[model samples]
Target chain A: MQNETADFEITLRPNTGWMQLDLKEIWSYRDLLFLLVWRDFVAKYKQTVLGPLWFIVQPLMMSVVFTVIFGNVAKLSTDGLPKMLFYLCGQLGWTYFAQNFNSNSATLVNNAGLFSKVYFPRLVVPLSSLISNLFTFCIQAATFLAFFAYYKYFLHTEGLRMDWRAVFLPLLVLQSAALSLGLGLLMSALTAKYRDLVHLSPLLIQLWMYATPVIIPLSEFPEKWRWVVALNPMTSIVESFRLMLLGAGTVEPLYLGLSVIFTLVVLVIGVLLFGKVEKTFVDTV
Target chain B: MSRPAIEVRNISKSYDLGSIGATSLKDELERLWKKVRGREVSARKGQFKALDDISFDVQPGQIVGIIGRNGAGKSTLLKILSHITEPTSGEIVLRGRVSSLLEVGMGFHPDLTGRENIFLNGAILGMKKAEIREKLDEIIAFAEVEKFIDTPVKRYSSGMYVRLAFAVAAHMEPEILILDEVLAVGDARFQEKCLKKIRAVAGGGRTVLMVSHNMSAVRSLCDHACVLHQGRLIQTGDPEECTETYLGIYHPTTESGVVDFKKPENETAWMKRARLYCDGQLGTQLEMGKPLSVEIDFESETEMEPGIGIVINGPEGAKILHASTRNAPSPSFRQPVKGGTIRCDFGEIPFTAGRYTLSFWFGGLSYDTHAEDPCFSFEVIERDLWGCARPYQAAHSILWWPAKFELQG
Candidate 1:
């Protein structure tokens, strides 16, 4: 026997491959992913004493931590904006990207039993994870919006300042998702090969948080070292969300445009790599 | 193989087991550096060839069983056929829809109910959504979980889980079905039903390729069998012939009708000897509804009372008859019985011919007396039936009926 794949010229019958990631099939299975997401959501809250309130409780707690550690303690300026809103904008972007990335990256390993026994484009697992993460991100975003509304009218401050830039916020959220999907797919493909990626991923994601402008504003960086921060793909994503939602900073068209281009490029390449790897990942995984 | 549905040509798979077993980060990193640049990279360490130069064809509407021991590459073959793992070399041309039941409930999410999972699992098995919708009721009915169809499958028993999984896979009606030891789940009764469903699926005229250690299942369902020993093809022919070959190849000491028992022989007030015969033939078939005799040779080394009897267990694990010589009035021959042979002949044999065993007791052991069963064995051949109402009783639980059968999906 040799180490070569046999692609016997089977009759060109239309199969799942022919279906070619048909969006219609995906739409039909959308319920499956929805239920899985709901299951995860419910299971998370089920035993927790706080229940679904944890969704609201989590970000609020994180907001307090950021306000103390970055705002009061470090005296990090939020571009003269309320510390809560400033961090909330960054938190939304960071939460969406990180949650989607972690879940999607582990999709293959998480369903290793299923993949070895059954055949479904293997892409479905990660895609399903992406959907669920989207749901979680939505919940968190809605909570943040509630906070934003309350701060705007009820608090009675310039904190209510309006900016037309917020309308592009959806695109920013979408870009974060695309970035996550790309990186997640790439890591998933690699993790199947190097299982060490399983242990390495979370630490890397945490370290990556520091590299991106997640906890602190990109403005706080030393002028000499700003270029490096600007180079991180997530740096622009975080900055874009802050600019769009908080209206605290001006958009660097070059950086934002570059982030968008990178997102599209990585998305295409990630999908291709994902497809190619899924063809025989069972062996390595 | 006629009009091959799945053809595997010159396929092989090799697995590299790195020097260290999988461990946590601390252990892996310590070894990763050593494993990467170490001399253990070649002959002494890395590769183990799981399958080598394996090739076979599964014809459309043909049921082929691949029989092998634990590591003789059965799984590797199924994996390649399903494209879950690509073959190391060569090519496989799959002609129709290929559904592999290598593991049941493979993609089922515990969060989903049986209804939702049927659709998800159907898609994973290669059925389109509309097709799954059409088969939903059939699947639910076949699984016999209608009451719990809308409830989460996590609440289902393991038997129910596999049943639902099998139902979904079967409903797909794939042109080809590849199963890998997935039938060992669920209750025995459910297993029987699953076999029936598989037969029905095959009756639909599609190809099936199965790998199972259970020789009975292979013999009952497969039209053709391929034997694999130590990662090489040993034989391919009728299921019975292939199984015999595979068994002989693996255990050289094994002989026809001679079970390899390790205990030393003993004959003490025990029916130490027994044999099954029909029409004075040895180790041969018996006709159903014919007079038959079971001879038991025992030793009354101690002494016997009125409760001593013989037990003849028929095929299908049925205890068909018990004849006792103990109850007979004391000695018509005017000789006290000690060690002697007793013969029991039935005016009519109710058993269908296949295989059965005989055992006896010095007293009513069924009601608590002393008796030892050497685990005797026997086979009942199909009654040579000619024309009208032959009174044929099948000795087996499930009949192969000798048809070249294939199960698709």
Candidate 2:
């Protein structure tokens, strides 16, 4: 048996300092993070007929709806890209962001029962949600890639050359995950004491979707309004995603760099607030 | 020797009595907007102190039991020590990995299989995956749920679920273990099994802190005990002595012989007040051979037939005597509106010397209209029983009935 005494010393205080990450303590409990992520991934599809396939089905079905409403009916410009590929590409990023944001925002309230009875890094709750949702996003992204290949090969669609800048796709995904996670943490912290955010966030996320270039390409925007739209942190990521995969949408490096900075700032604020609130969330929650 | 395994210094916890958190988004936003506009936000009301400057220490390789009535800050103290919640002010130092079991099945997901939940619950308690893996078989065997380990826990019976949850908690090999009333669950045999595990764990030189209402269990298991009354540490010493003191304080009878109901029974009828008298004078303590009278004051919103019963329980929780309206010739209510004082008079009290609590019931035959527990507690002191030379004792005795001895030709 390992002597636990040598492992760590614990001291509890009423208030956590303004910035106390306790990164080492969180690092040691990484196994717990893994379990939390696994429970979420498995329990989500346990009794469903489609099981984990719901991951692919959700994005696929939404893509069809977007293709009809935005592509055909509304005649939204896809930057000369095929309708299926264009909408699917946009839906993939939005799905990951929406899912991560929604679940992570609910971390504290949803797990109140577990939180009150045990002690672990409170950050693990939202972090695990981010990781678990990433798995679902990857599965859905695979389906998008399959559709992209079909359009490139059999149809040989025009203006559909894959750009080397596609390598930045990982960076784009990371930015979205970080931004969603940060915002979610902030919301969760506030929601612990004020539950109004729980009912209001889903509607807010829907409204935010139109602000980002999820359905319409950035190229379709008028020159004067472009700057205003670029202010949304997700806009640059979505535009860059399309530019890399379809070689059509604009990719301004400055805008993308600004989004990364925004993400980091939000993340810091979120973590600080979460750490402070988690110390006493059980009592209020 | 080494320092104590745990040290707590002047720990206190207080909660806001207001709407604790925002009930809805609208309320929260309004509060925020009011704050942003620099308006006076007078929503928050009062503060309730749950724990008040509580300090204690537990030495290495010793088991300490915390005994108290409900709402005595036992849970708050454990929550602070376990890091589940923070105290309002104070400090706690733990020497090693501390595992707290405030409840069974802290993270048992009904959708997950028993095997999966074991790992999940273990991790939730800060156990590493490798540690849980090593004790998997032992946990399963201890829970007696091996046959259903692969099945979803939702399919298992509530007992099975508790057993599995308890098994995982019990398997944790922490240097310091804190438990709170989780042993109250499960059957008698399982309870015995859990007690054995707790004893063996303590015997293995681990520091243990336990809070339970089971006085006998504490007496048999703990090396030392602490008694808490209204958030303050009133006593700490031998387990037996601590438990005795806790019971004494918890069942206190008012000096005025009036005990109010802790909670209303229902919309129909409830106990308002209760009092005791010895030989027609208001008093709490009764002489063993003197006349005793109990007065129960009650009220009823709607008129209904109600039966009143007075039950006496001894210090050890055994029923010593019972007097009910049911035994009377006209037990049912004589009128539609039945609300007043019902008195029970005893010519010669038969109880031996001991602390006893009075319980009452006011309801129909099938259901209790209203019931009060520990409504009034009084001490019975021994007195001479009409010139009997035999010595009288209270221990190991319930009642002393009058008997005569004679020599026959």
Candidate 3:
């Protein structure tokens, strides 16, 4: 008789961290994540009357509000650039960070139906949300670029200057994304227990926005207050925006360096907490 | 010996009970204060045991069946094995790639088409996008949804939706396949097709672990069955023996009668009484395949013409057969003695050994004239040697009857 046998024995280990993320198995399933992202984007506009146009409309309208409130009414300096361009850039950047964080924070809760019923990386939910948010970022960024060129040519002025530090834009984006993802992973884990994160989120976002230098320039502060403003990681990001794009401000190397350290620490803590929580979260979340 | 595909060792899972009694906002504040002071809190909290020290081994190519009721920790075990959730205490060693189809369409988005969701569901199941793309044609063909592959799944029929979902899962060939009751969807034929594929996968020296409540399905598909009850592993052995033990524990009775109908009787509009009035007699007992007529004696309290329907179901609420007399015209509306013995003749019985229930629905008369659950009782046994009932006619041929039949020409 011919006997056929299994090739290997099954073994269970604690967890596997591949690609610096939770749910490596889900990372293996990233095609599905891309599909889910496509689905999210399509579903958002599928039945809506305005469709993809709503993408540009949201940031465009936010820029209008910020230009009026901060530029004309409060008379905040736009670093010698057009108020619309300055406000629009800040809005786009802030929106990317906000959406990524908010969506990641909501990962477990929003996809509870799926998470409870199936076995996959729970992190996949938030990761897909980040990907979909990327769609919104691209749309807003393209709109801003068109306006930047129009203003530069029509106004007969270099409305937005270019600096070599612009090559490091990806690092700034990575920092912002990493910070939000870390905080989001942390908050999602906390949400399983407290169940009050949903109520506290908007309030937290308002306070966090004030902490960020989205509406104000970094140079406006006194040397002493600069330390406080630069304590926020985004102050380095926004300041770098002015330094690299408009040459109106200088980068805070000390503050930006601290922000990087803080980002790494937050991410490590987020992963540890999330790992601990995913093991037992089925009963709670 | 072949290497074992899955090894589970001393896995125990428990969940703490939530707060006792009604908790007001003030009580919550007081509780928080007590915690801050580091004082002794009440130890009246309870814990629910979902799985208690379950240990099992699945050798390569073994198709293992897990049979249990709801909250039996079947799903919990599957999650732990699939790594969706971790075991609280115990450890599991699994060999080769594992795919779990705990729920179909687990990550499906309503806006995406069948084509889009196929890739999405595949990826979630641990298949690469390129692999999914390569198998896209086969997946679409198996799902039989090529025509509407581009239509959003939200617009597809529930059958199509399940078919596409199952197809994606089927195409992702993992060394070990863990399925949790997803076969309950799709038609019987497609279910058979899926079962065949599972057998093929197992036959190819791969492992398959299935958690199912369908006793017959377990009997047919699993070489070995493990019974679980109330978070404890009760028994494990051959499929027939384990199922006998399981059914013995599950369907116990004081009267020693196999059938039990503790079904809550509906007080609203009903047939008054429904039972088999077969072979010119009215009896509570019945013989298998007995050309029986279910006589329903109903009376409409008010003058109304309502559509009457009957659905036959099993213990776990799976509808076996459902038909409605809604199309039949009742001309005697607004009259006395309007109801009679509505006899529906069945040539043969299609059931094996199991207790069954009867539920009737009265609809289309008024908004309030719906009989939600009119549960009653019936039974089927091994057939007799004498021909009592005619063959049950299908579109093609007669299904198998348990007993032998002699034809008198």
Candidate 4:
């Protein structure tokens, strides 16, 4: 049949432009993004002994462990704040980023079967994980607020106060999400080809948490090493989160600016790399 | 004239066969070392051209069949068309909302209920939430899983699971559909239903591209077909001719009436050789109503009594006859073990004049092993069994049956 080819809806070629992000296509698949998010939320807790309760229990347990090891045993500085509140607040931000990052990093490898057989926006997977992990973050944040309330009202612990900057909590969450997703996308793309990174990722994330001020506040680090920690995009987000909610840590404006810039750069690079990999990862993966 | 629904222009895909998934640091170091020493390194050496310079056009509402033997690049082409993988060279233009069913249940979670899976799978297949909701009841009814809609899919039988998955895929209303051997699953009746559903989809003026090894399905369902062979498009034309070409690729010329298979090194049981005889003479052509027999040689490692089977399939790969030693009323052979030859004699071959392939199966009571290929091929020549010189036409049936007609007067 002779017909005009200009009206073709899709043209698959050997080389697409490097900057072709296809954001409209991703937007068109918004319904799939929503369903994938819903699936993650519903399926994650299936057959669990405590169900979504594990969401709260996980961070609480991690906070207690951090309180015992870093706060009580090691007597690490908590920026003049109570150990439970300090670690819980830190856990609140760190858990969200780490959970999203871990899941997103495994997006390609874990869903290789699905990716091989279907065509949707590959970003939909990590983006849905970002949304799904936010649900967990909300529950953990509520748990942190309960502890913050107890220390502030009942215990009336010294130096514990919510400031006007607490409004920046949503911004901090967004920054943490961006950093996680960016790094996760980068890692997932590399791991699809390398596979060695799959084994190295968890260890890297663990070491990365130590580099950030998750267990101990940035104030406790040596002055010379402060710049190294500042280079980590997560450092300012975690510090600013504790500073806003607990009023115990110092937030440097320059480092906060640097964190934002770093996150944007990484996010752009991650999205681009992930886009490049998604097209051909079915063969390598 | 209407526009072509799909135009695949000189599409080719290649893979580094040696380096796929071999990305560990140690292997990289070894490869580097080999390269440094001027030794031939295989890591980047074996570039396999899976689909080489393949091109075709499909018009709207055309149910096109992609027929090929395994490793003939059928899957590579489908993957490229469906966007699961990218072609290394060339391009394709598609003029519709393309949906590919490379697998039936690509994203189904075992813990999710059938109803939930319907939504998830529908979304993965590019359907909007409203679309799935609109067809929810119809999907459930088609799958026949209404009673188990709310139950976890892992709890349902495999048949029900396949039914549900196919029902969800069948309900999708994409303008262009790419289907792999998805119809090869399910029972005969369900497969027939799926074929009918595909026909209905095509009847809606949508384009369908299907890759299937089932020659009968290809011939019956596809109006046009393309034959792929070793990463190349060898033939493209009418379905009947293309299917014949595809089948010919498998058994180009097996007129010797004898086949010898290499003995498997460590297999417990294996078929060794087979020979066909027409009227007690070694021949590849069997006349209708003439006596025919097949002699099979087999070997077993242990002292276990194993049964052997022979299957004759028509030119379109549809099974015509299956004769198994285990199904015989009396024990045909009482051999205990080792190696031997067993000859099966057919009283009178009743097949219509056509080419047929023969497949063999060897199995014991506990384990079964089948020969990977259809070991032999033979032709049945047309003959006038009655006193008249009139021959039976294949349009009537695949077999010739004798009948006596008498007037009641």
- Candidate 4 chain B lowest-lDDT run of ten: B365-374
**Per-residue error (Å), model 2, residue A47:** 2.6
Which stretches of candidate 2 lie above 4 Å from their native place?
A1-7, B23-43, B253-307, B311-330, B335-355, B361-373, B378-409
Model 3: CA > 4 A from native: A1-10, A13-27, A41-53, A158-160, B19-30, B37-40, B255-409
**What does DockQ come to for candidate 4?**
0.58
Compared to the true structure, candidate 2 yields what TM-score?
0.87
lDDT at A154, model 1: 89
Estimate the TM-score of every prediction.
0.72, 0.87, 0.78, 0.87
Cα lDDT tens digits, model 4, A1-285, are 123423548988876766748889899899999999999878988888888888988788988998899888999888888988888998887889988889999999999989988888899999999999899998998899999899889997887889899997898899889989999999998888778888988988899888889887898888988888888888888888888898877578899999999999999999999989888888876
Which pairs, if any, clash in model 2?
Answer: A196-B25, B363-B369
- The sequence of per-residue lDDT tens digits that candidate 3 reaches over residues B1-409 is 8557788899987776774222344556777888999977777478888899999888878899998867888988898887777766788988777888888887788888889888777877778888889999999999999999999889999999998888888877788889999778799899988888778878877789999988877888899989999999999989989887775555432221222223235533445555555443554334555654666656554444545677766544467777666444543233334455556665555554455565666533443344535345555444543565653333222234566779998
Show model 1 residue runs off by greater than 4 Å.
A1-53, A261-280, B1-3, B17-46, B250-394, B397-409
- Stronger candidate by TM-score (1 vs 3): 3
Cα lDDT listed for each candidate = 0.70, 0.85, 0.72, 0.87
What is each candidate's DockQ, to 2 decimals?
0.22, 0.57, 0.37, 0.58
After best superposition, candidate 3 residue B153: deviation in angstroms?
Answer: 1.5
| Candidate whose DockQ is highest | 4
- Chain A of candidate 2: what's the TM-score? 0.96
Docking class of 4: medium
True contacts kept of each: 0.36, 0.86, 0.47, 0.77
- Which one wins by lDDT: 1 or 3? 3
